[model samples]
Target: MTGNGGGAGPARLGWLDALRGVAALVVVFDHSSATLLADFRRELMPEFNTSRFGIMVFFLVSGYIVPASLERRGCVRTFWIGRVFRVYPLWAVVVATVLGLGLCGVVEIRDFGGQSAVTVAVAHVTMLQELLGTPSLLLVLWTLSYEMAFYLLVVALFTVRLHRRSATIAVTLAVLAAASVAAGAALPASALSDRVGTGPLILVGASVMVVAICCASATSPVLRLFGGVLGALPALVLVPFNGTVPLWEGLVILAVMFLGTAVHRAEHGQGTWWRAAGTAVVVVGCAVGSAYRYGDGELFTRRGWIAAFLAAVLTFGAGLAWRRRQLPLPLTGLGTISYSVYLVHPVLLAVIDGTVGRARRDDPALEAAFFAVLLPLCVLTHRWVEVPGQAWGRRLASGPRRKPVGGPERPLLPFRRPCERTRRWYP
Candidate 1:
């Protein structure tokens, strides 16, 4: 996920940058451990799923900042444009790099199972491949599916003017998660794909997404509303029935994000602290209870998942409470490159694993070396790839000097730019 904003200058949101940096490192460690810290990984994973911990933090960060970005822009067309540029360029680069490496025999990509090249390509293009029954070429990409779903749902809520109902939405999703478990809604991964065939589902999903995005971006009010509602339908359908993760956890992920929005609302005076607090209580309780009831997965223990979930929430709360404090440059810099680190590390690891092979034992030295290598590369990618793309996005989203005949695009709500005294709140 992206940190506060596009530019990597003096970060106004140092706390968030620090959090993103911390989460990225944890995720890197989680993946790197498979090769470098095998012995300790066995000991660590059962007590703490570092992957879950890191992703939950990322999701929270995205939840907090992404909607703010959209609302700040106050135009669906520009919001989509910004999101496209912010996400896709780097994604395209990474995907192509992986494919190139695979072709060169430098890294063996994940098998796409029985899916054809056309299907896999289209699914990945949609960024909902994980939910569309296509195995991600890069394992880490699975989280992006949920991130995309969150984006869709956010747009839907914003279009409908229900965005302020963050607390209610969070509570509803959490309750649904709990209810899913209680009702024994145990669907296998990709159940929809299994029934309808992966090709058909992918085609339909991609078509709907295209229509939804196009219509939402259209100037017509009716089209925007229809598109918003239509866009949300796929996510609402897929996350519950077709995700690789269990149904309850998919619902919980969305709940966690909206809970972040609730906190944002509370801090900005659009909502009350007690409402945010109560929403958190319901979300955390339901998430923990759902995990406990769902029992241990093959990779993670119930206790570990519960612990990680609580830790992520607490970490976010701590970040928010300490948002006013100045943070170290190094930490914020890491966060600036956090998205690059998240996407690039997997490919790096793949190359290393393919060529050098996994370490024979818990080699802390090797792990340290991997980070030493990874960080510099990620910093370079961040500067060269992410910064330029975001700049272009910002330029495009700001739009042409000549205004259209329709007058200025509709504001999501009349938002006065925060005065200097209130700048920190915006950050």
Candidate 2:
């Protein structure tokens, strides 16, 4: 959650960490059970949709923290730099490892459906392959597309001095989601690719992303503003027409994120609690309404969707209610390493599926074994890879060294200075 260089004390959000840990474990269970306990998965998925439940929690947390991260630093360039270091290092490693394993015939890679290697590569690098008519190398990477879009939109609002209007933005997007359903606007997935073609779109998107990040990070106000808009517009445009999910769901995702921001505002005394509460109601109503009207898809059941959505909201609310209380050490520790848990589990699962194949029957013991192996690996990766990468990012974003007048330069810490009461959370 690094957004620019700043002094931030260690995060005090034990409840949030606990919530994240819960969500990460649930997501792991959802995926692992599908492979190791298919009969149980078939029974549960039709009722609960655990994957959706886990991800919605993640989205809400991201919404609550990401904007605050950017505003606290008050520097777009450093924010982008921090994000790059925070996300890309491990992403690069994971992708390379997966690719090497595929090459070594330890696992199979996903086919790109006739797209050129260069186009697919560029799209994945931009982290928008999901929206750009390219398949995700890893299924979970699809969520990162929306996360990246949220980042662009958040920066756009911040640069324009409209970041404080979270409630309005949330309400507006929710209304639009409902309206899209009502109007029967049925756009096919990857509509942008259908028009511009996948190869060209990937090339253009990659170039624009490069320019946008560079310009937004520049010192010049004009460049920064231009870059911000350039970055946000694609997400704004594509979500309606090119997203894999329905247009309404895409809008709901944005709305849900802004709702989280509104809650953050209310908690911080920058906005009234009533306003946040009202916005939440409107967003929830609109999301459920949209789903009802759109009907269920092959992968999504309306009952499951509604249940998961409400459950996620309730879980987040519960966390907020108990935000000040101490949480279990194990829960907080899992939260500390949740990102590694999220990213690494899929790779391990893939390897498991490749080597041993999925269990034909329900195997709770096998599921437990998977967690036993995955948790320790996540701890190691978080300690050695994520921590060091974030530390390096802090040093780079801290800018040019200013020699002390009399004393030696102090050593840099891996953590940022705490912004008042603000704490870091990840997507």
Candidate 3:
């Protein structure tokens, strides 16, 4: 997102915006169909949740974009301050609103408890609710938990003199990842239980992959070639996933991260083909996933053919837009606000489900219409409540001397004045 030349502001990757918006919509559709597509949304949306895909897009984008932001500002302290401000404040609003709505009978509460409330309070405020456990207010927040982990790792990477020595970081990460895999293999049954799980192993793999990509960028020849392939190899493996979906889901997320790194390394205004290919794969992946989840198993069958057609059509549409440099503003805006939107919207829909709606199962049209209404309400919430609160948080984080985005908007990630000498040094 940063430009090292002439103090230019970071550029938003248009395709990522497009991806976020699409992911949000897919999640919305999945939730909306909870009333209509009982086999799909409620019973198996997790199995088929492109929401996770959206989250992957988000985390990967965060991993790349936030670093770019750090480069622009040239300080980790400011970077963390801004990142925290961006996520948490708006999240606080969501928690309070959901709890308030539930307590007032505006929404229904499930598993409400002191522990539930307190745990979520502590975990979310720290941005660890997803990592530590499930969220109390909303179900979609686990992605944020992993995202926060990645952010922490990035901070560590930048702080340890590792960024300046990409090769060392790569070697360290690679060794750790290999050791983790071995440890997972060697762990006693007691440690391998669901309670203990493979999180360390997964994280290790991720760390190695990140270092390798960064190292490849700095080097060339064999490492670069292998790293280049890895960059989107994860995505290619996972996006069009089917069969035993949960395992593949985890793999898909890793893929999204690799792909995101690839996106970050791309020169500004370069690789129209990469964006086209990536977006197209995601759309097609969703379609194939939908078919796999709800349709007959045979690929040559009518339903399978239809799924292929749907995916192909989506691919064509995305490709056309990518080629034309035409982007959907609403989608991009949703993408911008999407992490908040995804986290908050499901709780809102859950309320609607428990209300007069009563989770209608007979009518796809009515359910779809409900989403039409609910998603916008969530967006309105993003605009009025979440956005403003985040602004305040950023202001608190950045402090005075920074300009507000609007008359009343606040800054996050405050920076010390950059002397001309500092700018010259980086460039």
Candidate that scores best on lDDT:
1
How high is the CA lDDT of each candidate model? 0.86, 0.82, 0.47
TM-score against truth, every candidate:
0.93, 0.91, 0.60
Cα lDDT tens digits, model 3, 1-427, are 1101112321335555665666667666666566556655544443344444444445445543565555565544445556655666667677788878878887776662334344445545545444333233576655654455445444444433233232233233323333333333222222221243334323433544465445433323344344434533322321212111333233333334433433444433323545535543553354345334333445443353343234424432453347337577776666666665576667767676767765445576776676667667767767776667556655654554544233643223332223111121111
Residues 165-249 of candidate 1 have per-residue lDDT tens digits of 8899989999999999988898999999999999999999999999999998776678888999999998999999999999999
For model 1, the stretches where C-alpha displacement exceeds 4 angstroms are 5-11, 296-300, 403-427
* Per-prediction backbone clash count: 0, 7, 3
Candidate 3 or 2, higher TM-score: 2
Which residue runs of candidate 3 sit more than 4 Å off their true CA positions? 1-12, 39-49, 112-117, 134-136, 164-255, 268-324, 357-360, 397-427
Q: List the residue pairs that clash in candidate 2.
A: 4-79, 7-417, 8-416, 8-417, 8-418, 9-417, 9-418
Worst 10 residues of 1 by lDDT: 418-427
Rank order by TM-score, top first?
1, 2, 3
lDDT of 3: 0.47
